[model samples]
Target: AQRVTQPEKLLSVFKGAPVELKCNYSYSGSPELFWYVQYSRQRLQLLLRHISRESIKGFTADLNKGETSFHLKKPFAQEEDSAMYYCALGGRNTGFQKLVFGTGTRLLVSP
Candidate 1:
């Protein structure tokens, strides 16, 4: 079975402070990790992907095979960055390219 686990349900931080959303996965084969964010009433969008190794909206996540973790990070937290963040895992082993998402973490940035 494949699973994505985000231990923190909520991460509160002050403006300009650093932020980190922890994500861990359990899978038998190589996995593709991604971060999805939903702001206000908007639909969920991809924030970053491990294979891309690119940063979007000042956020980045790295996949650590040894630890089976892909944690999202940002040096500074902005009010607009507050959103519902989800960690997802996908791989060929799944047969149909289905993504398994974690419960999700809500980021709260306060002034």
Candidate 2:
């Protein structure tokens, strides 16, 4: 079985604080991992990917094969960055054309 799990429904914090969004996945084979973010009144877009090893909008994610996790992290939370975050897993066997997403975690950045 293959699945992605995001443990939090919401994460609230003050501006300039560190942020971490936990994600865990279970898959049988090599899996492509990604982080997608949706801003207020905007479309969902790819934040980062495990394969690319890139960082977007000051956020970075590292894939840990040993723990089956790919956690998103940022040194400081910004008000503009506040939005809905989702961890995703992509594998050929899932039958989905793209990636399969976790439920999502709402990040609330307040001043």
RMSD of each: 0.6, 1.1
Find the number of clashing residue pairs for candidate 2: 0
The sequence of per-residue lDDT tens digits that candidate 1 reaches over residues 65-111 is 99999999999999999899999999987657999999999999999
Instruction: Give the runs in model 2 whose Cα sits over 4 Å from its true position.
Output: none
Cα displacement (Å) at residue 90, model 1: 0.2
**What TM-score number comes out for model 1?**
0.98
Predicted candidate 2 versus true structure: per-residue lDDT over 1-111, tens digit per residue: 779999999999999999999999998888999999999999999889999998888999999999999999999999998899999999887776567899999999999
Best by TM-score: 1
Please give the range of 10 consecutive residues that has the lowest summed lDDT in model 2.
Answer: 91-100
Candidate 2 yields a Cα-based lDDT of 0.92
State model 1's lDDT.
0.95
lDDT, candidate 2, at 65: 96
TM per candidate comes to 0.98, 0.95
